[model samples]
Target: MELSNSTLSSVAGLQVVVCVVFTLIFLVGMLGNSLVIWIILCNIKQQFSTVMLILNLAVADFTVLITLPFWIYSFADGWVFGAPFCNVLLYVVHCSMYASVFFITAMSIERFVAVLYPFAIQKWWRRGTIGKLTIGIWVSAFLFAVPVIDQKATHVEHPQCSLLLSSYRQQKGLIVLETLVGFVIPFLVLSICYALVAKRILKMTLQSKSKSMKVIRSVVIAFAVCWLLYHIINLLTVSSILTKTSSPEVSKMLLNISERVENLAGALAVTNSCINPILYAFAARRFQNGFNTSGIAKLFQQLNISIAEKFSNESNIRRDNFQTSV
Candidate 1:
């Protein structure tokens, strides 16, 4: 599978294209997600389960955007960051991916609970509890990605970071683990949760229809579609590993196709971050108002007035007390 100079140049050109696409997606995603965070923290008052879930989702997306420069550099000049930095970068990237999936699944569950068992939420779903669960999600994602840290390495000769195990047996095992734990399990959970949520929304009272169930459905479906494509590509990669024969040329072609598909899927995954803020703006009335002029401006004005009043009252009280003492 040795590459000639021309072939190497061609691959470098392809990588440059990928780098530009990913960088653009990452920048737009960062802006949109940061706006979502600001709107949630500064303007939104209700702080429901859905809000918390959205916050966590934004956090995961932000984490990935923060690490994008490292990946962009890797694509541009190969993995010159050495083995340790490569390991850390891969670990962070995978951790963000896992965390993103888990948070989306959590959002589905929260929607299901809010729609189906609204009364039960008061008993179990508090802000503190959701915060704790978010922490657990981060910890779980980090642990899940620990194996990748050990399994990934930078190839000094080719200057590419990739999975360490090139052996068929090891690759098969890793692919199985990745598919089951990383994709299949999370997808199943999210699908079931969304199913229940849809059923609940359908059966809800008239007031519930006026809510943002339609928007929620759209967001969930978009995420599911993106992840489904990613998982399908992963399945193909696994198939490539399993069907590997002694034909070097055929094997190289299959590997190249798998790698290209994987790059496309990764790009699609980054698109998810950008989609979320748009979903929020369009789907939820609160988010729309808070993100726009009326709600956010009014909130800042009210805050400033309250602070001024508090200070004025304090000064008045101090003067009165001083006069009385004199």
Candidate 2:
């Protein structure tokens, strides 16, 4: 469809809005993740598995946030950076996305194990297990993202970076793979984990678990809110493709609609990167009083779940009674 000059002008304005939103996400995500990572590394004393998981998660989020500038430029102008870099960016972004979700799933499962089978963890779970799992997550992400390498390009008019898969089967398969591996499996795992955790915690309340778990739980919810739309759009695209079997015009229309709505979905997917740090800040509750050091920094020192065990016997309800002030 050819855009008239007026339409082009309107699109240009909309592109500016997209760029602005992306830039804000980039800045906030980078700053928040950076601050958390720095404090975790330099300031926080006790480095437990939970902390390591968080550090890895922040790094994963940060990796994707760093790639947003290229995307912002791509949206505002075009893919002037050439196809090679575009392909690399696609791989990194995709890999990081997979890594982030996998890390969340890992954290959830770890928390489950810690809650249910404490003895197994005490006996068999080594300190380096999470490190190895971190490595495996990156490797698995790379393997999952391998298909997209060199597949992205400036195919359409105005040179936007897009996935231009050559085969219909490949496109359908990519959607299926993403839906299953990225969304469905993780959703099931997390739902089951949290269901059991909630069952156990019903008597315990949020106070029974450390705020670290609260932060992780909030991150899981944010991830769902952000990426759920993207996956739904992916399913709709698959539906469109399947609909072509009977009604070509209807399929074309559905495809067009999906395409139009897809930009916003993609933006939300990246928005999850920034949401984590904001959740971390809230979980830190750093603004409650004057602090000599970073409130976020102080939250890390007492992030362990075991620290909450002492509260199991207490009947009085006060979640913030022991809150630290830097």
Worst window of 10 by summed lDDT in candidate 2: 310-319
> How accurate locally is residue 304 in candidate 1, as Cα lDDT from 0 to 100?
29
- RMSD (Å) per prediction: 11.3, 6.4
State, as a TM-score between 0 and 1, how close model 2 is to the true structure: 0.87
Q: 59-89 in candidate 1: lDDT tens per residue?
A: 8888888878877877787777777777787
Off by over 4 Å in 1: 1-13, 151-159, 205-211, 245-253, 284-326
Output the lDDT of residue 14, model 2.
Answer: 82
